[model samples]
Every structure is written in structure tokens, then in C-alpha cells.
Target: MSQFIQLHLLTSYPPANLNRDDMGRPKTAKMGGVDRLRISSQSLKRAWRTSEMFKSAIDGHLGTRTKKLGIEIYKKFTEGKVAEKEAIEWAKSIAGVFGKLKGKDSGNADAAEEKETKKKKGKESDKNPLLTLEIEQLAHISPGEWDAVMDLVDKCISEKRAPKLEELELMRKPEKAVDIALFGRMLTKNSRDVSIVEFGEDAACQVSHAISVHPVVIEDDYFTAVDDLNKHEEDAGAAHIGERGFAAALFYTYICINKDLLIENLGDNKKLAAQTISALTETAIKVSPTGMQNSHASRAYASYVLAEKGEQQPRSLSVAFLKPIESRKYDDDSIAAIKKHQENMDKVYGSCADFRYSLNAITGEGTMKELLEFVTK
Candidate 1:
């Protein structure tokens, strides 16, 4: 089996905000001593994992990242014909196991005893409404673990009591979801209460932040929206007007996949591992993160991809742009630069991978079908 799969992709987006920074501008990073438009690895990973292509390729194997476990539990119990009040209590007990619960406990006699003790001193107040228990952070709970949690919640409600902390700890165990295996999870809040011994799974795939091959010059698109309801009065200029930052660049993307870790993450299922690699590569090639898609409509597929498979150590070819590849309208400067980097790597590392395949859109040639076969085989 191949130990590693490395992908080098060159994609171009024209005048769109594919990813944004805190200031709502296209994310940029300084690379090769020049400012280059950047799409974060986090953004890229999310777009691929949640893409329709990925969903279809690996159905029912994806995990959900959310903080609404309490709401889900509440809905499930109520749907099971449990009363709303009792359901909320049951949900709170289960949620508290994941994180600290705010407000007074609404469940058992221990809480009622405290309430009565406070009332004896005339200190109880009706101003506080019941607050639902919530996890401090969004948890990446797998489908199997969700089923387990639901079952435990059902058991708690059936017993007519709150869940014990030790029982809630069961939710933390890894359930071998594909996305969890690839992206991993990190739970810092209430880690002591869960069965998770580590902070998060070490990601088997490493994605570099996508950066423009050439220096980027930010452009501002100024525009206005007319009020459709307003009569076209001479004085009725516009309903809204805004300025947005946009850029066009040929981006360089690099990804290194550790096949061994990937298989382990998928519970030693070789078939699932192949499916994961296929889904990841396809999504990475096709999906652009939807940052301001409606506004800018920036969507594009990779112009070129070089897929390599081997048991050799993995390395990125991003050093090709260390001098900043010069791009032109009618020229293939970016592609040429990457090719030069690959040649240099071959000369230096003496064949970086066991096999290599190339796909180029400009030439309208190269085999994605064969590359996928190589990676999977």
C-alpha cells in the first residue's frame, strides 16, 4: 500500500471573496516577500467535507460539528412522547455531562432541597427562568456517538432520574467517523468528564493555506442596489451602496495525505480509506469556499493538478513560488513555475514519489481517472 498521497493543485479565482479575514476583506498572507491572496486551510477543509460531492461519495459517514446537542436531545425525547418539561430536564442532565450547566438544576430532589433551603431564609426568587444546558464549545460528534448519546438519554428518562457523570463520560469515546478521522476534534471544555484522553485526533491530511503564485493587488468594487419598491423618482437614487474588496489570482494548493493514519482513522477499513481519498481529491478540485459567493459569485475548478502516490516521505512544491511566479493573461507562467519546482525536487530529492500524474486544463489533456486509480490502488 502507498504510504503517502500528495496533491499539487493550481486554481484561479477571478474577482471574488472566496475567504475573508476578520475585517471582511479577502484573506491575504505575506509569501515570498509579497502579499498574496490566501484561502485558509480551515476554510478549504470545510468546503470539501461539506460539499455535495463528498456527501454522495461517503454517505452517513460524516460527523457533525455543533453545540446544539441539547436541542437535539430535547427534540428526540419530545418526539418519543415524553412531556416537554420532563424532556427538557432529561436533555439538561445529558448536556451537563458535556459541559457546565448554567442556572439552577431542574431535575431532582437535591436541587429541590437547595431551593427549599433557600426559601426557608426567604431568598428564593422567580426572576430566573430555566436555562438549558449547553456545551462550552462546538463538539464534532460522530453519528455512532450520537446514537449512543441518544440511547443513554432514553435510559436516563426511563429511570426517572438525571444521568450520572460516569455514564455521560461515554459520549467522549471516538466512534471512527471518516471526517473525524481526517479533520479531528478538539474539546478543551469539560474534557475531564468525557472518555476522550487526547485533545484531538492528529489530522492525517495536511492542507497548506492556498496562496496566489504572484503578488496580489487588491481591487475595490463599488456598486449600489436600487429599491425595487420605490417608484423610479429622479430623487430616489439607490436603496443601498457598498464597496467590497476583490482579487484575481492563480492559487497554489498543496496537500499531503498519510495513508496509514487515514486507514487507522477509518477503523482499518481499506475500502473506506480509498473512498475518503477520492472524495477529498474530488472536492478539493471542484469546490471553492463560499465566502461571499452571492455577492461576487467567485467559483472555479483547478486549472492544473499534479497527483503523486508513494511510500516516500511527502513534501510540498510551494517553494516554486518563493520567488513569486509572474502570471500573464495569455501565458502559463504559474504552471511553468510549478513544473520547474517539480523538476528541481526530483533533482534534489531523487524522485520524491513512486508515481506521478499530471492534469492540465490549458492543454485540455491529462488523466484524472488514471490518477485516482493510482491513489486508490
Candidate 2:
């Protein structure tokens, strides 16, 4: 068995009351003869994206001070990297695709209008028509869109473009560190209590990244930064603000503080890992359900990674999530979406097809709360 931290998070509204039958449909059961929370991982991740921390984190990764994505694109195009025709077409297409401006389709124009009216009667789309517009601009960059970016830049330079709510949205940064890239590596490894042979058991100073041989979990947030449903028409999104948000998966690097001593005793790794896990047991009480901010946890991680690291001196370990593309496709879906969401993800793997690392294929729902106590031998 491996000694590590296990975190359990779920959406507050999802009620955690989950039960599945033989066919995996909603069923009911009693543990203490009572119903418990049934939640989905997707839902849980959504909640975390909406937290304040995630928003701040997104701001941290991408600058939030400017609203020049359109402006930036425009500049790039004007500089002649992209043709003017293409840039405008991109802007028009993206606006059409993501915008809710569709009042009617030719086949059922009247019917469509009626349906739209009914929908608008309730909750309605954002009050501002521009909300969807901004979101669309942020979604894609084409030749025309690039010109729009230039236009935006021009506007901002002339103090024309104003920051909107959409500009505030941010995305999570998954590949800020090589070590976190490795954490996904260790998580996929099937061996339990398997001390990495690459890094010395007691090598503390060199430990750039680490992962719990067990589970590292986070609390669920109700608001998500990258949710498909949260897309807006006029939000202008991070693009309007010259900032961006992570609407994708994230990777983190961890370290064992008591590595040297644990290695010397061998048996001590469990205790140290357990204790350290305990300290991090407190899950995020507040996170955005919509904004999965990618804050560089390196600074904060330093404390957690080097926690209780000593004058007593001890060896440490570092691990990174295998570059997303480098890790084996635990399944087909992961491979498809993992890299598409983050373009840089593909670049990191380069031509190295050595992605043999495993992935923790969590099947059932419910937080593995008890795994927190799973001790290492």
C-alpha cells in the first residue's frame, strides 16, 4: 500500500447523494441506513472553477490589466503575419458560432423566433448583447479575428475598449512546471508503495517535484471557469482584458518534506507522508465553478513541497505529470481532449512518444475520503 493524501470534493448543489444500480443509473442505498451525497467528478470540477482562488490564479497566469486580445490579434495581422480578409472572416465566424444572435433559421424563422422569445422570457440571455460577442472573440483567432484583435488594440490604445466582466475570466495553467508534468506520471503508475528508483529516496535538495503515491484531491466548487455552459456572448472574456482563463485540466508538482529521514528508515516514509497529507487535508472551501485559474503554485508549493524539510537534513523526491501527450492514453477520450485544450501541451512532448505513464482511472464517484488513512508499508 502507498502512504499519501486523499482529497474528496463535490459540488454543493449536487447533494453528494449518489447511488448506482447494476446499470449505473441512480439508485438508493443506506450506509448508516441513510442516504449520502452522490456527485460526479465533472460537477465537482465545475464548482472549483468558480472559486475566487481560481479567478485569482487565472489572473496570475495571464495578465488581467489589459483588454488587448483583439488588439493583439489586430497588431499581429497589421504586422502582416495574417491576411486582412482572413482576420475579418475569423471574427465574423467566431461571433456567429458562439453568439446567441440567432433569431431565426430560414426553415423555421417564425417558430425559432417564438422559441427564442419563450426562452428569453425566462432568465433570458445576458442583458448585454455584447456578452456573447466578447466570449466569441476570445474563443477563436482567425485572419479576420486577428484584425479585430488589432482593432481592439487600436481601441485600447485610443482608450476606446473598456474592460467587461468577460475580460475577468481566466483559465488554469496545467504545465507551469516539469515536476507537475511528472506527478501525472506517478499517479498513472500502478505499483503501490513503489519508491521511484530515479530519484534517491533521501535526495531532498534535488526534489523538484513530487506526488502522493496515494491521492491528492481538492474540494468541489460550484462555479467553473471553463464550463461550456458558462460561455457568454458579450463577456469579451479574458481577451477583452488582455488576460486569459484556463478552461482545461491542470497538473501539480509536490514534494515530501521528510524525505531524507524517511529514506534512512524506509519505514518512516509512511508516517511523514501521512502527516504531511493531514496538513493538506483541508480542501478548498471556496473556488470558482467557472474559472479554473492556473496559478503558478511553485511559490506556495515550495512550502508544501519542502514542508518540515530540515536542518536535520533529508533526501527529497521530485516528479512531474508526464507531459500530457507523453503519458499513455489511459483512454481514447483523454488523449483527444487533453492536448486540444492546451496547445502548449503538444509542444512539450515534442517527438517523444515515450508516454508510458499510467493514469488514475477513477471509475465510481464519491470522494475517496478513507484513502487518506491508507498507510504505506
Candidate 3:
């Protein structure tokens, strides 16, 4: 079996804000001394992991990333007819096993602001006082850990008491959570006993921020919304006007998976590991970031895909685009450059990969099934 699997992809999107900057414009990076649109690794991973396709493929093998575990626990206990005060305390005790509780002194600015906003609106924010039970950070809870937590919740409600210290040991090796095994997660030490907490897992896969292979010029789309009720000539003017930033580009994405580490992360579950790789690879090739999709509808599949497997150290083919591809023959040139670079790299580095397969949509060279098999097999 190969130790490493590297994927190179070229996908094109038209006039869309696939990923956005803080200012609501398309995200960009200065690469090779040129401005190129970028889709952040974080954004890409979130899209792939949360996509319906990935979720359906690995339905039972996913984890939930949330800070509302305490809130959920409190609600569950309350629904079981537990007293409000007791429920909050019990929920805190259980949630604290995963991460620090968001207390009055926790200095969580966002929570504070939300509470203050509710107060200003003359709403009784304390109506759901359990909101304060939320944790300080998002916890990635595997299905196993979640089941354990729920079991403890049921016990506490039935026994009419808080969870025992031993029962609070909710951390479990993620045998079923493929998302956790692929991306990994960090769990803070238990507030009660640091030694009792399971720390974290190292990510078995690394994703690069997808960047365009050519220079980009972001453009603004200015338009107006019309009011159908207004029929008079004086009311012919648009009801609302706005402008949004957009750009079109062909992006290059790279992913490297440490198959050995992935299997180990899943507790040596080779079958699950293969499924994870297949699901992830398919998601990467098919899923598009949801940002501004309603307005631009910019969904795309990779036009060119290169999948390589080996025990050798992985390297990205991004260096091929250091000199931007000309717009005249952008897609063809970009693909050619990548192929040439891989060939050159093999010559200089003595075969960077042991086996390789490619799917070129432009040339109709290979099937998706064949490519998936080549990588997962």
C-alpha cells in the first residue's frame, strides 16, 4: 500500500465569490508576485466535509463541531423534567469534561455582545438562562463521544444527580468518525483533572489553499432590485441598489494524504480509511464553496485531475504556475505546465510517486471511477 496520496486539481469558476475576504470581496493571495484569487484551505475543507455527498457517503462516521453541547444537554435534562438550576449545573459538569465552561469571567466578547443586544431590545435574555452553559471553544465530538455523553445524560436524569467524575470520561478513540480521523481535532484538558483528558489527534491530510493559475482582476457587479408593485413612470426607478465583488478564474488545488497516518488515526481500520479517502477525493473534485452561490451560481468540477500514490515524500505541482498562464489558452496551458513540471520533478527527484493516474475532462482521457480506484485501491 502507498504511504502517501497526492492530488492535483484544476477547476474553473465563472464570476463568483467562491471564498470571500473580510470585506466581502473575493479572497486573493499574492502568488509569484501576481494577484491571484484564492479559495482558503479552511473554506475548501469545510465545504467538502459538510457537503451532502460526503455526509451521505460516511453517514455514521462524522463528528459534530459545536460549542452548544452544554446548551443541548441542558435542554435534554430540562425536557426530562429536571429542575432548571440543577440541569444547568449538571450540563456544565458534563460539558466541562470536553472544554472550559463559558463563565461570566471567561471574557467571551461575542457571547457578551449577544447578551447585551438582547437586553437592549427589551427581551428577557435570561429566559433561556441555559445559554450561559455554552463552552468557550467549539468541540469536535465524535459519534462515540456523543453517544457516551447522551448515555450519561440519561443516567443523571434518572438518578436525579450530576454525573460522577468517572462517568464524565467522555473522550473515546474515534473509530467511526472519519472526519476526525482525516482532519483531526484538539480537545482541551478537563478542568477537573488535566490528566484524564484525551488531548487531540494529528491531521492525516493536508490541503493547500486553491489559487488561480493566472493573474486576476476582481470586478464589481452593480445592479438593482425592481419593485413589482410600482407601475407608474415616476416609480420606474429601482427599489434597491447594491454592488458585489466577483471574479472568474481557473484554480489549482493540491491535497496530500498520509494513508498510513489516516489508517492509524482510525484505529487501523483500513476499510474505513479507504472509504474516507474515496469520499474526500470525490468531495474535493465535486463540491464547491457555498459563498455567494445564490447570486453567482458558480459551481464547478475539476477540469483536470492528477492523482498520484507512493511511499515517497509528496510535493505540490503549484510551482508550475509561478509564471502565470496566458488567458488565450489558459486551461490547456495550465494543464500542460503541470504535466511538464511533474515530468521534470520526476527526473530530478527520481520518481516523486510510485503510481499515477489522471482524468482530463477536456481531453476525455480517464473516467472518474478509474481515477477513484487508482487512488483508493
Candidate 4:
């Protein structure tokens, strides 16, 4: 049997430009200089999203049901069952309150969205597993913050005329997002036993905080890592890398894959699976000639295609890291490196019949062998 493997699907985002000055050095006065990169959970998730692996991991869980989420909503909207005005209002009410609800309702938000589809689809949609709010993630906000935000949201829908989804999203700013309830809220569900900052300093935890506060900042270790949200697109430091908005946030939804089951299925095919895992992870991200996406060199440093997958395919779970490829900057050398890794993945997956991005999912849409049989429960 091959040893075990662990894939830690991860992403990093930066906070507002590190309060820089004309010289570009971090502005420092009283408290201390700010961090160079403000990594956030949203940014990390966006990075994770780019990976075919994350998509597959979750798809394996959702199976064909994955596609149904969006389809169900679209289908409902088209059916005229949900009033455009009402739906828009719902979105609006969701937005302002979303900031605080960001943690507690994160998981449920998904389910809530799914629930709407069921209402539209009727009983047919009821049986499938639907996306729910990721309370674990949302609970990161402070309880006071959470209650305040939710109250505000209730007023928006309960009182405010139909709200705009676009408008609502803006209300949920990340400024106070790191308050105890939102960052890692699930960690201190009891609340009574919690402290000022409940979590110990895990690298991921620190990285997520920086990203949440400043969505446009990237690490200095990478060239032009800055995507300053401060910029109006004209602003030199406008949102960069993980800091980019929802488009960036969308990528954070990667599923951690269990490797032990994979090797067991592989049997004599273990080597093939191992190589594919390495290659897919290798190409976890690709950097184009433009923007700061994944650089090939990152493959070596947990950079290009940072992988959390264990070296061996064990029942253990893991994730693959991906880098940005658009709207960011990367060096010429970095571009070349990513190409090689991507090519490696193409060949590896092409040869492996059982392995696929959706392998872990029960839906047939998932190509990953792990998911071919499961259905949304």
C-alpha cells in the first residue's frame, strides 16, 4: 500500500494596501507597521477554487446535485414562481446583513439558497442534498457584530422596499469582519468560555485574517503581488490577487479530498493515481503572461501549485493550492514554470480512468472516480 497523503486546500488574501506612502514603504507611526500581505479566508478560498481539485472534492460530495444548485435557482426564476422583485429583495436583505451573517449563516447561506430552489422546484428538488450556509466560516464574526448585522438585515427585508442584490453585497464589508464571531466563530460556539480572540495563532488563521481585512493585497514575495482595492482601477494598488471581490471569493469553496479511499480503489493503479495527484497538484494553478496567477516556480515552493495532499494516497483528506492567473502580475520565469506543471496534469488525468475532479462526489457529472456513484443526500 502506498503511504498516506494529505491535501490542505488553502488560499491567502491581503488586507488594504499596507498603508503605504510615496516611497512605497509601509507607513509606520504609533502602533507598528501593518503586515505586508493581508491574507483573508475569502482570498484563500478563491485560490482553492481555481483548483480543479477543490471543485471536484465538493462535486464528489454533491454529485450531479452540484450543477442543480445554480440550475434550480435559474429554473425557478424563469418559472415566474419567485417574483423578481421579491427575489431581489431577498438578496438585498441578505447583503447588508451578510457582513455579520457572513460567519454564522455562511454554511446555511448555501442551504438557504438551495432551499429557495426547492421551493421553486417543489418536492422534486427536496430530496437532493443542497448547499447550506457554512456557519463554521460565518461564525468568525463577533457575536455583538453578528446580532447587530442580522438586526439590520431583518429591517432591510422586513421594512425596506425591494433591495438590490448588488447594493446588499456592498453593505457586508470586511472591515470588522475579523471580530471574534466571524473569523473562526465555530471554535467558540459556547461563547461563555471564549476570550478576546478565541483562536491560537495558526498559520492559516493569521493568513485568513490579513486577507479578510484587505482583499486586494498579495504577498511581496511574489512580483507585483499588490492588487490594491484602494485603486479605482486607476489606483495603482486597487484590489489585487486574493483581494479582488466576489469573483475572487467564489474560488474559496474547495473540498478537502480523502486519499486513502483513492489508493484502495487504485489497486495496481496506485502509481498512476499518485502521478496524477502529483501532476494535478502540480498544475493546481497556472500563471499566464499577464496577471499574478500561479507561477510555475510555485510548484516547488508550495507556490505555483501549492498542494496540501499527502505524498501518499491514504484515506486521509487533503487539498491542492492554486494561484491567480488573471488580473494580477507574474514574472516571465513564473509563467514558464506553470506551463510545465499543467501539461503534466493533462497527461496524468487523461490516463487515469477512475480518478477525476468529481471522483469524490456521488454525482455522475463528477469525472473523478470517487464520486461516480454518490448522489446528493
List the RMSD of every prediction in angstroms.
Answer: 6.0, 22.3, 4.2, 19.1
Instruction: Give the Cα lDDT of each candidate.
Output: 0.79, 0.28, 0.87, 0.30
Off by over 4 Å in 1: 75-93, 96-132, 164-175, 189-199, 232-234, 327-331
Between which residue pairs do clashes occur in model 3?
none
Give residue 38's error in model 1 in angstroms.
0.8
Ranking by lDDT: 3, 1, 4, 2
Give lDDT tens digits, candidate 4, residues 325-368.
33333322233333344346547754211232322111222232
Per-model TM-score versus the true fold = 0.84, 0.23, 0.90, 0.23
lDDT of 2 at 245: 17
lDDT of 2 by residue, 208-260 (tens): 21121222222332332453554577563443222321111222222232333
* Cα distance off (Å), candidate 2, residue 312: 39
Better of 1 and 2 by lDDT: 1
Candidate 2 residue 181 Cα shift, in angstroms, is: 15
The candidates, ranked best first by TM-score, are 3, 1, 4, 2
- For candidate 1, give the lDDT: 0.79
Candidate 2: C-alpha lDDT: 0.28
Candidate 2: minimum summed lDDT over ten consecutive residues — where?
Answer: 181-190
Error of 2 at 261 (Å): 37
lDDT of 4: 0.30
CA lDDT of 9 in candidate 3? 99
